[model samples]
Target: MINWKYCIIGAALVVVLGMLFRMMFEYGVLIGILIPGVIVGYLVNNGYKNGAKNGIITGIIGGFIQGILVYITIDLNLPPFPAVISYILVFALFTTATSAFLDAVGGIIGALIRDKI
Candidate 1:
């Protein structure tokens, strides 16, 4: 069974982090929606029971989705449709893995804090 509360809070935190990153970076996937969603997913899945392994898996899955969405949506803000489509296949694998790891770290931190509080 999944813990909806943790998931919701973690996801919300991620969204807030994303917005903040967006504001700071102005653009780019890092501070965008990618990290936040991934972090939340990782946190939610790990719950307060199991530990890092679950978080890692959640992060990997969430990050993949986020990366793909970011890749697809980036073009919405720019021109040259082909340019956007062209790179889609390029970064998919690497970015997903990277985001997953990053989110996993965040999840660990969030879980620790959540347990304390």
Candidate 2:
């Protein structure tokens, strides 16, 4: 019962809005992730039975995509070979985890609100 459409939309929002905020303001990373996380949380809560799971999936997809984009744009230029791969993996993991946690929290909150209403 995973809703692919909402997941894709959430990912798209994360990428587009994440980039937009990154370019226009300070604390862009946080703000970028927050907006999309909240949106995804709300959307996921509409159909998903488990808010945490839905949020985690949405966050992973969106965060990983955003992480790749950021990685490509930033161009850390780490030493070639294994080092580069390691760096990418670490960065991707960090970004994905951070976003997932934040989005999960938002999703939980959204679910609570939905339940209350």
Identify the candidate with maximal lDDT: 2
Angstrom error of the Cα, residue 66, model 1: value is 2.0
TM-score of each: 0.52, 0.79
Candidate 2 error regions (>4 Å): 46-49, 76-78, 113-117
Which candidate comes out best when scored by TM-score?
2
Q: Model 1 over residues 1-117: C-alpha lDDT tens digits?
A: 445555445445444554456557766446543455444544554453343444445445545555565566555575476865557755556666775566556556555665665
Clashes in each model (backbone N, CA, C under 3 Å)? Answer: 0, 0
Worst 10 residues of 2 by lDDT: 40-49
Rate residue 106 of model 1 by lDDT: 58
What's model 2's lDDT at 64?
Answer: 86
lDDT of 2 by residue, 1-117 (tens): 456776677668777887888899987876777666566556666633466666777779988888878876888565888877777778878888887887777667666666666
- Whole-model lDDT per candidate: 0.53, 0.73
